[model samples]
Target: MSDLLANLPGRHLEAWHYTDLKALKSFAFAAPAPAAIDSALLPDLAMNRIVFVNGFLDEALSVLPAWARLSSHEATKSDLPLAILNAQHRQAGIAIDIPDDVDAGAILLISISQAGAPIALFPRHRISLGRNAKLTLIDIAQGEGVYWHNPVSEISLADAAQLSHYRLQDEAEAAFHTATIFADIAASAAYESFSLVLGGQLSRAEFHARLGGAGADIHLNAAQLLAGTQHADFTSVVSHDAPHCASRQTVKSVLAGHSRGVFQGRIEVARAAQKTDGYQMNQALLLSPHAEIDSKPELEIFADDVKCSHGATIGALDPEQIFYLRSRGIPEPEARAMLIRAFIDEALAPVTHDQARALLERAIEGAWSKLVS
Candidate 1:
């Protein structure tokens, strides 16, 4: 554990260049101690609920859906430093499996942290879907106090399976969060994920996905709402190893005050990955002069017959649009908020799940209020 912590990536690594971990060295974060659970942290949904208090799975509070089955498993070792840390400190985790042709309704997985001092929680989860299975997973992370929430999730989909995954991170203002998601998509499978990040003092969400079979489709989309001096980084790497696979990514950020937002997206196409289609775009709207956004979109293609493209844009609210709104009796703050919402709505258009989309929309509205105030 000490060696892994010593080798934590810093600004030296290109992947971690925009977001450095040097500040973490100054704080001594012990393993999170068990605390009283708060039911308010759980969303008021009738679907299956899985609660993890400080990284340990709470079977007493978890309510499994009819199509979902829970089991125990050992954590997988990884070369990544954060993954290694999670594997070492993780206490209890959940492994869920969905049978073929089952449409598992909304399943909520909540991770809550309540610690007195600087602490850390490493929670691990795995989801596997059989052939032709479909499921929707809503992952929420919230907490109070100064702590670190480090979570790792592994997902796999069989041939023709489909999974819609949504994640919301609204941690405490003083919290630090680092999350990693690794997904392996099979032939003809469809995997879609949308993430809304609105909290944490300094947060970084990293996603790495591999298209392991032909005709597979994957979409990775995210929105970040930041205020004050908060920093949020969304990094992703999508690898296409099979032919006829399609991948798309769209990331949007709304920054206020002195907050900083970073988007690093990479798409890789192997030599044999012919007929692969990949698209990525990132756009940011800054609400204050001191706000900043750093976007890096890269595509590495070794195949000849593949269509891949990437683009990024950063700017403030359009003065003309804001003026038009203000002329119609809308206040300056309300006009700005309206424009910001419209800008972000473009990236969120692809989300199809009703419940998930509504949740993200609400988060965006709340974020807009904070940004304008």
Candidate 2:
């Protein structure tokens, strides 16, 4: 364990060059102790609730729906340091299987961290949707503490399966978070994911997705609202291994105070994967002079017939738009907030779930208030 911690990636690794983890070397993190479940921390949604307190699943608090098959299981091993740490230190996790042709309304999995000391929690989740299955999942990480939350999720979608995933990371101001999602998509499968990052002192959310079969479609969208000294990184890699597959990604960040944001996205199209269509765009809005944003978009295409493109943009809010809003009787702060919200809403346009979209909008509003205050 000590060796793994010692060998963690730093600025040398191209993937983590912008957001280094060197500062964490001084913090000592023990295994998180079991904490009581607080329902108040959970989101107000009409869905099955699965609660994980200090990274351990609380069966007593979980309300399973008819389409969910839940059981205790260990996570798969991975070479990534954080994933290795999760597999080694995870106390409890759940494996959920959705039956074929079932339309599961929604399932909410909430991870809460509450400990007396600065500790670490590893939560693992594995989800598989059978052929023709449809499901919506909302994964949320929220708590009040100075701790490290490392989570890993493995997802597989069978042929024609559809999964809509929404994630919210609203940890405490002092918390550190690192989360990764590995997904394998099959033929005709549609996987859509939207993530919103609002809190945490230092955090990174990553996704590695593979289109394993033809006709598969994937959409990855994210938004980050950072203030104070908060730092957030959104990195992803989408591989098109099968022909006729499509993938799209859009990421946006609104940085204020002395906060920093990073977006690193890569799209790879294999030689055999002809007719592949891929697009990636990352944009950032810096509201303060001290705020910083790093954007990196890469495309590795081996197929000549594929259509692939990547681009990034960074700028501040449009002064003309703010002035126009203010001229209509709106205050300066409110006008700025409105423009910021509009900027983020464009990235979140792909989210189809009404409730999830509303929740994210409210979270953005709350974060904006803090930034403009």
Candidate 3:
């Protein structure tokens, strides 16, 4: 840690601490550039909405349904980590709410601008789903140059509520991003999340979910494609505290060029969580000698009669599979790409949007071509 970082308390740390201090000091520090929004960035989606551009709330572009509420607050007032960064800088993000008993859909749009400056920005969001309410959230992040973006999202679920969240990150070479999402689940509530990391210099998304009531259910799945010198990390922690609760997670990544990838997952079943069912799996593909991947999956069960399992695999393209395709007259590069695609298809199976999955597959195929050629 630099003297600047050591002197700055985590809460009182300066904006430079929000990102790599060395990078910011070595380079000319520039204020974050504004992210421009395209007209109709989101078509008439069924859900209520909150929009943030360049980490700042854009009320004019947000659509607050009659059943929903949204606002931006000083970080010190909330449990979120924003205060740790905000105490030293301005609040660059916003908060969101969905009242109980409201049959509404909600989406929060987060975007980055095309400005050619390395920068750092923070965003904070909070959501609550009332009894029996249903919500769908779509979050997107993109940028132009090398920059750092750190975001935190917190959610609370009431009895019988359901939440579906989708996240996409597609940034340029100079971009680095880290995001953390925390959720509290009520009895019989459900939380399903799907995330995609397609581009960035360094990107990591952390998810923590806890069952606060009996019989809660949670499902999380993520896929990442790393090319060039880009890197990505997907970390998750799931805890089952109530009896009969269930949780499952599957994460996958493809590493090419000199890129690196990481996946760390943990599932914990408390003593009271009897009859819990927890499962986790992580798999990776390395397409080049210089590409690297690391995975760690763990299960801690204190309850008797609970079923839990965790597994991880890291490997390169299977030569036998590649030969089979090459023997069919396909070029070596194409054959290898096909095999790797098949290996990763299972990770994308849960994606609800066909178009999004297709776009991701196309991106993966393009990455393979670049790596092999």
**Highest-scoring model, TM-score:** 2
Residue pairs with backbone atoms closer than 3 Å in model 2 (clashes): none
RMSD, every candidate, angstroms: 1.7, 1.5, 4.6
Model 2 weakest 10-residue run by lDDT: 65-74
**C-alpha-based local distance difference test score of model 1:** 0.86
lDDT of 2: 0.86
Query: Candidate 2's residue-wise lDDT over 283-356, tens digit each?
Result: 99999999999999999999999998888899998889989999999999999988888888877876788888
Q: Per-candidate TM vs. native?
A: 0.95, 0.96, 0.83
- State the weakest 10-residue window (summed lDDT) of model 3: 1-10
Tell me which residue pairs clash in candidate 1. Answer: none
- What is the number of residue pairs that collide in model 1? 0
lDDT string, candidate 1, 156-272, tens digits: 999999999889998989898999999999999999988889999999999989999999999898889899999999999999999999999999999999999999999999998
Looking at model 3, residue 105 earns an lDDT score of 52
Model 1 alpha-carbon miss at residue 109, Å:
0.7
lDDT of 3 at 195: 82
